[model samples]
Target: MIKVGITGQAGFMGNHLFNYLGTKSNDIELISYERDFFKNEKTLEAFVSSCDVIVHIAAMNRHEDPQVIYNTNVGLVNQLIDACEKTSSSPKIIFSSSTQEDQDNLYGKSKRDGRKALEKWAIESNGEVVSFIIPNVFGPFGKPFYNSVIATFCHQVVSGEEPNIHSDGTVNLIYVNELSAAFYSEIISNKNKSTIKMIPFTSTKKVSEILNLITSFKVDYIENGVVPNVSRDSFELNLFNTFTSFIPKKHFPKKYIKHEDDRGAFVEIMRALTSGQSSYSTTVPGITRGNHYHTRKIERFAVISGKASIKWRKINTDEVFEFILDGKEPAYVDMPIWFTHNITNIGDEELITLFWINEPYDQEDSDTYFEEV
Candidate 1:
């Protein structure tokens, strides 16, 4: 197994990459890293020496003073190099540079210089360094303003704030999960070269176009409780998932409109603009089901009969969210990607739940990972 460590394991991209690597425990052993290690030479050296590969992702992205951003980013690369040299370690370093390297900004200059410094270190120390010139990245849990336009727009729309576009220029974007997969592939490749690779963008969109898409998501999914028309693995689906991640926990357990007549009462379980597979399950009293999560699937659980308690917890997070639903008042809770969840029958009698997923389950590639909520 390759012993790998990420320098910025707690930051947005770092967290995504770290969690993605966690899912490959059989082939890789993750080395823990903290931001504080940069402040201590001994600790940093120890971290560098213990790893077979180090993913250098920690870097300053924004600051009031552009020079501070530049200095901090370059300083971080130098520090990592110092730690490697001090410990006589020659671990392969995978540096997360950016497409900004070609732009006329201090941030871009910092990335260029950092990559150059790492390349120099690799040549001198007989080490390996693969620098990725990455495009704009977007995904769940990104900082509203600091991360990217998608993150800022998602947060603004979800928080009832209008998103204003300063520039409608086209942008090349890559989803965080996709970027993480690329990083994982690089780690597995274990190439012995100090070269740079331009990571291809998965989607391209104008700033205004993205805003329109996410705004429609708010209107359809958030307000009307209708899933947007998006196919599996489409950019729209990824953006929709990212938009949903910003929704407040209280927004869930949305009550379904009940239509009552002389014979009986009926409630619509789901309304989707796209095709999906629907299934139902009956659970005995006090029994729990679904200690699993999906990475790309859109799923919903509706309590059609009996009382049920649905719980959710984002992977690698400590906080948990829960909702209670009853048959009398039919309601549902949608599952966001990367959050482990479970449903428990809380009532005395058997509980029935209607499940809807964006796609039919394929055993060969289920995209389901089991984890406790």
Candidate 2:
């Protein structure tokens, strides 16, 4: 197995990449990294010597003084190089640069200079370096104000705060999961050459266009409890998923309205503007139904009969969210991407659940990963 470590394992992109790599434990052994390591030479050297590959992702993105950003970023690159040289380590280094390298700003200049320094170190130490010029990245769990504009907008919309657009210029974007997969592929490729690769943007949109789309999701999904028309593999679908991730955990287990008549009672299980497949299952008491999660598909579990407890825990996290539902008061809980979830029959009678997903199951590319909640 390849031993890989990430410098900024706690940052937005770093955390996503770290967790994505965690899913491939059979092939890659992740080396733990803490921010404090950079302050200590011995610890940093130990980290450098232990890794087969190191991804340098930690950098100061914003500060009141632009020079501080430049100094901090370049200083990080220097420290990493120093640690490598001190330990006589030649581990392959994957550097994360930004598209802002061409802009007339300190952040851009820092990325440019940092990449050049790494390139110099690779040449002198006979080490491998892959410097990626990445575009704007967005995804779930991103910091509202610090990560990206998309994250800020999603948070604002979800929290009932009005979104403001400073500029309507077009933006090239890549989802965090997509970028993580690219990084993983590179780590496994084992190419023993130093090179610079441009990570292409997967989607492009005007600032206004993105805001409008997210606002529409707030109206449809958040307010009306209706899933908007979204197709699998579409950028809209990814954006919708990102928007939903910002929702407060307390908003879930949404109760459905039940209509009662002389004969019986009826309740709508789901309302969507897209096509999907619906299935139901009967689970015996004391049995659990699911311990899997989907990466792209939107799924929901509605308790139609008996009492059930649904649990969810995002990958690489200890916090687990749970909701209880009964047949008498119909309710549903939607599963978010990258979260392992399960439903248990907590009652005496058989548990009946109605399942709805945005797409039909395909064995060839199910996108399902099994994990305990």
The whole-model lDDT of each prediction reads 0.94, 0.94
| Tens digit per residue, CA lDDT, model 2, 60-161 | 999999999999999999999999999999999999999999999999999999999999999999999999999999988889889999999999988889
Global local distance difference test of model 1: 0.94
Q: Candidate 1: how large is its RMSD?
A: 0.9
Roughly what TM-score does model 1 have, to 2 decimal places? Answer: 0.98
- Model 1 stretches with alpha carbons more than 4 Å out: none
Assess candidate 2 and give its lDDT. Answer: 0.94
In model 2, what lDDT does residue 59 have?
A: 100
User: Cα deviation of 126 in candidate 2 (Å)?
Assistant: 0.5
Report how far residue 247 has shifted in candidate 2, in Å: 0.3
Question: Residue 198's C-alpha lDDT in candidate 1?
Answer: 93
